[model samples]
Target: MKGSRRAVVLGLVLTLAGCRKGKEEAPAPLPPTPAEAPAPGAPPSQQQALPPDMRRALSSIAPLVESVKAAVVNVEVRDAAPSHQDTPWNGEGPDSPFGEESPFGAPFDGPREDAPRQGLGSGFVVDARGLVLTNNHVVEGATRIRVQFPDGKEMDAKVLGRDPLTDVAVLKLQGDVKGLPVVRLGDSDAMRVGDWVVAIGNPFGLASSVSLGIVSAKARDIQAGPFDDFLQTDAAINPGNSGGPLFNLHGEVVGINTAIAGQGSGIGFAVPSSLVKELLPQLEKQGSVTRGWLGVAVQELTPDLGSALGVPTGKGAVVTEVNEGTPAAEAGLKPDDVIVSAGGHPIASGHALTRTIALEAPGSTLPLTLYREGKKQEVVVTLGTRPDLEGVASREPSPEQEESPQQRVGLSLSDMDSRLARAQGLPRAGALVTEVVPGSNAERAGLVPGMVVVEAAGETVRRASDLARVVRDAPPGDALLLRVAVPGGGRVLRALTVPKQ
Candidate 1:
């Protein structure tokens, strides 16, 4: 019995030993302590993101901010008449809503008052010898102008020139201003809509206030002036932000802060740097902006109208009228011609064409493509100086009038005869718009009751019948372009979409 038991135990031991030998032996049981002594201490409490690619490249704007802070400045001005100033600062008296909403317009002959009205805005140094750039209204009609640097050094500034047409101006520091930093200019045309931007300005006398945002839009027309293409940004620009530098991510000036919405939060407009580049030299050389003009009234094309013209909508401007002896007329451009492209760039709208011509140098030949009568043709026009932009119609609206039906668009019109025109202080011609029916085509086109409708369907409208006839002639589902004169000396082009049904 003892022998059998010993033999069984021995066989079991052999089996256990063979199994242990076949197994690869567990990793030597990790060590009794950490392999590298726990990294010497408690491992870093905080560490940067791993792999380097996980971090944003521009985490610090300090270096850029420091480099540009010197170029920006606070503009202070004193005006003789407080109430009558074209641009008042922030919210002032009853005129608060009107301040900074528009450019400093053509001056009126008014007596200068002794009331000392102090204003604050912003500007930037452009020349190392002390030349500065700012909005014209920032220093317009200033009894005295001063510039204060970020370093707290204040110097008197003299307006080198002013161009209210472009609302741009150049200034020279009257006193010693050495070692002032100048900011680099960037291509406004190259900036994308989502690109980051920064604004540095003096808001409400707070000098050098910085705000960050993105480019919200470009080529925005706020109806402030004839040349109203403005870059819109949501960069916290405020009342005193006018004439400040709008910087791109590259630390370059891409725009100049000019205006904020009369009723909005963060909605601000800046004159683009491309325009600044074009206007600066002219403003510095001549005290104004000299633009190339073609002497043609234009309106944007709609899809239905584009179909009628055989061109794509939003691709060009249609010639409503060409003034005799103007470059456009000289070039044989006729009414209804579609300017598809001009000056080597695609025309996006009437505003785009207007901007193209205005930017081209006077006397330069501009190559243009016109889609006429369902075919495309090319024309070359030697540009002419844009005459002083006309303010809205000189005629004012008088109260006396008779209403007649404009059935196509639901507008009430009146004949501008000698009796009615003289009564309303308007010319004895054209159709005066007396009423626009709510929710009608005319109303949808923004045809106000007091405006003067001078043109309809691209033809001069002389009487109620003229407008009615033009409206009646247009085929159903067609669009009509109306040139109306706003009461505030402004002209606007409106489109009435005639319903197909």
Candidate 2:
């Protein structure tokens, strides 16, 4: 029964992988140079050429490519996947920067009981001494990392440090290095939508391929991770393109290509260089990043909620439930408190608040502007270290987690209380599954018990009755959409084939 559900986890951020979008401009082609001039005596009409405008457009990106291609490198990693390793795996390598006790595991790939695998990605040299920047997802769990340059010179590299929260990793060449070719990082905040950009990376193991497009969007929040102010581009960034540098016309690296939207064609995301600027020193020194947390649950205020709450602006992050003894509770923050600003800056949404708080240093007191009970007030709260996604305030598992597994086709869902929800970092509303029957449809569909069912049949399933109703309403032999929290962490959508009654 456990094998029936297919769980797909898009990493660090959700990515869509496919062809290019129709609206995006294709890479500009280079015009024929004077060196390729038609044979000396060729007739004028026989000498074919593109129009002036086309030639000019095609030539704009070639100079930028020539300037930055030297810094781009292809990264390859070979590692064993959850099988036949001497040390009992806790989901990390021997030198994990997070240390042994970290709750984070070996990324959100499928079950580990498989064989060895090869990971392909990209990166760029950032300094003359051979410091390289790339996505953490590219090098994580790598047993050996090999860096290949434009001239096909491959060198051994060691992981210096990685900030998984931001999906950024830094590496260094094995020996002393100086005066090596490098790429300059630009201000990602200065880039606007429709701005021309180019990407140089190894896609599908093809080395040093170049693609160009405009910045399709910015500050995209895909919910792949917390620090998610991604710059979306139409550049052709495929699987092997992760960790590559997305360059601007000035030949500066503006973003680090990280993910391809798993649903869209030609849509890719990059980590802003501004954020990379902040993370460099910390990752270089501390080996991991520690972010500040507000200890409050909040969500964006919808129009209906705004009307009901009497909010004048009808915009801000609305407080959900303040946990006991947390900074929010201690600061007298209550449910329905609309956070309008932090340290004088306006808060746009819950995600904005999340990013703002995370940027602040822990243990520092920060001021918040809030609207409560139809009155504006100021509150000061001390920030705490950001909690692990799977480690919620170190709360113990709820007794509900210990309930005996039941059987419903293949799944046995149970009750979930606020305490368990907080402990598990789960949505407040969901039906918890305790078991999955072997050989059942749910099993075949990869639905494991202990995985929380947040939505089913395209609707919220907060209770057992909701699950039953959704199951009953489904047409026989068709598939039911279920968004479930897979065991160990990370959420995935599974298509559970409904067995005919």
Candidate 3:
């Protein structure tokens, strides 16, 4: 029994030894490398990495703002009248609303004391030698004009030229102004409606004020000028903000601040800079703007009018009247035909058609698209130089004609005839209303050229003389009510009050 027990103990001890050997045969862990170890006293914190593509885009447009800020300038104009100058419309005067009695009880007769009128506006240097760009309204009739730089340097500026029609003017500096920062011009034609833009101007005498906004709209016609293709924005432009630069994100001038919606909360407008580039050469050469003329009166195509004229929906201006011996007549473009496109650009409106045609150099052949009686056609017209009415014909009436009572309604009126109505594109024949003089009685009567008079003074006037006799027969009164039939079929009742004689 002792021998068997010793054998069992030996077996158990062998099993234990096998277990210990297995434990001792286990592999050891490898030592840590220096590269994998954390820094002496610091531990890793949570870190996020940006994408590679984002880093590249941020670097591209970072310099644009800085480059644009250097070029914009603030202009201040001061007009010092004579010390004895008459005070015009003083609100606190006896004739003013704030004064005693009716305030307006007395009429202003003579000039009173005068004070110097100071005006503030913005302008930008367009040339390195210090030629500045500003609105003509800024420095017009001002005795003294000064340009304030972004660096706060004030220099006296001289008006180089002023174009009131376009509201654009150039100012040249007399003093030393070398190395002036000039804004880079951008192609405004490439801008879209929603593109981001910046405006730098003086609003309410605040100099070098910068505002950012997107292009709210394009080709806005405020009717401020013939070439009024404005860029509308919500950039907080005010009265003194005129003649400022509207810049794109690329640090280039895309538009010029010209006008604003009256007392609006945010609506502002800028003239396109592309026009400045186009007119700058002509302004520099002749101190005036000269554009090509087709001598054709065109009308915009309305949906109903387009259908009646058999023109496509997207067609161009409709030639309502072609002047005799004009380039339009010479080009075989007749009345009622639509000008679809010009010079490879689609002509959508009468304004656009006129603008594109004006862009072409005088005597240059312009490729034009036309729609005639539902048929598509094309014509090449050689544009002609515009004629100057002031140089060719004087507007002053002869002294002998002064015996006639001057019409105070801002219009010169005559009775309409069927032939004249047809020439004016009237759908029906009626007594014609001719020329409206500026600030004349007929003008105040809301009478426009080419209007047919169906009734006047509660009587039907069949002839121009009959209408004139009615006006001559009526005693001076405050109002004249006339029921007129429109040529297009609708009957309109117009009430025109006579101006106090």
Candidate 4:
């Protein structure tokens, strides 16, 4: 059965090739008495020829492919593999949620300790002066790097700059780097779904392989990084295709092929060219990117949450917590403020706000429109340099020595005294939740033990009675909005539905 299938597929390919050849304007003359040639004026066999309409639709993109193939190159790197002791797993098992491998390539096998690990990936020239663009993972921690063009010419290269957050890297070729072929970057924002695109790369070490497909989706968050706005494509991106170009029909590079779905075929992702364009200047000059910061944690305001907060649904991001001594706090931006716009751009979600802030320069003052307490207000804030969040750790709360009677909402609350405050790494105020009943309103609202209730119904809750009083005064079936101080340094809002007595 397999052999028969292969024969059928091979025959189809040859038929397509023949159709393409027949469409060419210039044709080679054939011998007058050639054998196996179809007679003139005779209808072509249905099994051997495609319909006219189908052949036209499959018109060759040879001219478009030829224009951009020269800029594409193969990237080779050699780095030392880490030993088991140096691995980040730290005794975690495969079932752990963070144990999944990166989608860019196959998982690294355990090699001999400090062994040289050789890798292959694809890249393209973006400037005539030998500047190349590729994925940061391609040459990360490499002891040696080489760039090989489609013509088999090799040149040593060095990392100009790299941004791991977006998985983009820029390289500079060594030696005489004059008049190199470059690809023109296109606007990824303009590429719509189902638009034709071509991919050129060295998949699996096969140099200069080409594949064709369309944009499958946009703005996909695959959890690859904090800034994970990837362009999903049906193009055949594989292990060695990382950092290659995804070109549009006009021969303009739209995206850099980055990763692929491990268990699925025809599902791949690329970094949009628009984002790469924004980083090119800094990557070339400063050798790194400096992102502006607004020290605040935010959450997406769903329709129900928006109606409860008296704001438009799906319009803005809700500020969950404002860090102390930060630009947000200095500008009087408080928790529960809905950010509707920033710097004249409308903020649609938390991710949008984050990306906007990160794109701005540090120390740049920007205007922000916010909805606070059902009143619209505008504030100007000076951005700060983003701080490293990797070192921030959440402390576990100690066991509570006393327990209160369960409330109607299924929460046992107590006052946050000095002992509990120090243990939980929180301030000495608010009502602390000692217990939460399973399958109850509080649990359904995400109320868990160790969470401190800072405010209830827009009022401060310094003790258990303060929270109970607000809950009691609320009408049945109404959601009691509560601001909670989580175990970490951030705060979150939860709405618990009042039970009918």
RMSD of 3: 30.6
lDDT tens digits, residue span 1-501, model 2: 001110011111111222247787766656566765576788998976634433344444555677778778888664333331221212234543224321111232222343223456788999887899987766655555678888877777877877766778899876556657898888999989977788888776677888878889999875556667989888776667778888876778889887665446777788899999888887788776778888888999887887788787767999998888777777889999999899888998988898899888888899999888778899999887777764422322232332121222445667667777777776667778766655556778888756788898789888766776677566646788889875456799888886432
lDDT of 4 by residue, 205-236 (tens): 77888888888999886666657788888877
Cα TM-score of candidate 2:
0.61
Index of the highest-lDDT prediction: 4
lDDT of 3 at 120: 69
What lDDT does model 2 reach? Answer: 0.69
Order of quality (TM-score) = 4, 1, 2, 3
Computed on alpha carbons, the lDDT of every model, listed in order, comes to 0.68, 0.69, 0.62, 0.73
Those runs of model 2 whose alpha carbons end farther than 4 Å from true positions after fitting are 1-58, 83-114, 391-501
Q: Pick the candidate with the highest TM-score.
A: 4
Enumerate residue pairs that collide in model 4: none
* Model 1, total clashes: 3
Candidate 1 wrongly placed segments (more than 4 Å): 1-58, 81-114, 312-314, 391-501
lDDT of 1 by residue, 1-501 (tens): 000000000000001111244457633323323433445445476433233221233455555566687788888764333343333322234433335433322222222233233467788888888888887666665555678888888888877776665567788897567788888667889978867788887776677777877789999876655677778888877667778888886677888887666567777778888988988887777756778999999999888888988875557899999999999989999999999899779997898898889998899999999898878899999999887555311221122332223434556777765665555566567777877655456778888776777888779987778987777667756888888765554678988876432
Error of 1 at 245 (Å): 0.2
